[model samples]
Target: MSERIKKELALYKLREIEIDDMKLKVEELKIGEQLGAMNYEEKVQSSMNCKNNDYVMNEIETLEKRIRFNEIANKRIDNALKRLDIDEAEIVRRVFIEKKSITLTAQELFKSRKSIKKSIDRAFEKLKLA
Candidate 1:
């Protein structure tokens, strides 16, 4: 995968939270807290159907689309990580998921910095194909 995508893998956990938050917001809108979204008569009549309000429906659709995109990205990264060997996966998790510096990760793994860097490179290369 490209560097952009690899880096996005670092955000996988955050994306999970974001997707849930967005779904909650969409559910709220659907359940008719859409008071201000629909005008007077429309508000009274449309409480039964918020989709009558173009803006609210558009917002819900947008949120759903974003949730889908984040889910797909998370799945892609998860699949790639699963394809890695144990050592490579651990290195990727420490450096990317845990946001450790290479030196710190090397120290924790009890390896030299050069060995850690080489493993990272190899993992990324394999990830691209995965």
Candidate 2:
């Protein structure tokens, strides 16, 4: 369970970074559209039926789907954290989400290293991840 939680935390961090990058890509696509550089479609539909925004939206649709997937994964991680007590959640976050060592977390949280380790063990017992 501990190992699984750690792996999920790592994936959560990765998904978060990916979501941010994909959002930036979407923004760049929009900026390109505004700059009259919209050329996302390889083949044209009827020009009478097609609007300018419609041209690039097809491309943005794929990117938005990827962004939404990562967002949902992050939300699941958030919900799991919400199930924990505040202190348990904080310890888990510092140890896993922040990638901090028990010793470092102890120093930051003003607790002993042994205390931090105990809290981490207790938190791991209660944590559920997907």
- Scored by TM-score, the top model is 2
Candidate 2 lDDT trough over 10 residues, lowest sum: 40-49
What stretches of model 2 exceed 4 Å from their correct place?
37-56, 128-130
lDDT of 1 by residue, 1-130 (tens): 5577567867987898999999999998888754455556775564554445766779899999999999998887778888888888898888887789999999998999999989989988887765
Q: Give all TM-scores, in the order shown.
A: 0.68, 0.79
The per-candidate count of clashes, in order, stands at: 1, 0
lDDT of 2 by residue, 1-130 (tens): 6777788887887888899999998999888877765344522655533565675787789999999988998898899888887987898888888888888988988999888888877777777432
Candidate 1: list runs displaced more than 4 Å: 11-14, 31-53
What overall lDDT, based on C-alpha atoms, would model 1 receive against the true structure? 0.82
Candidate 2 matches the true fold with a TM-score of 0.79
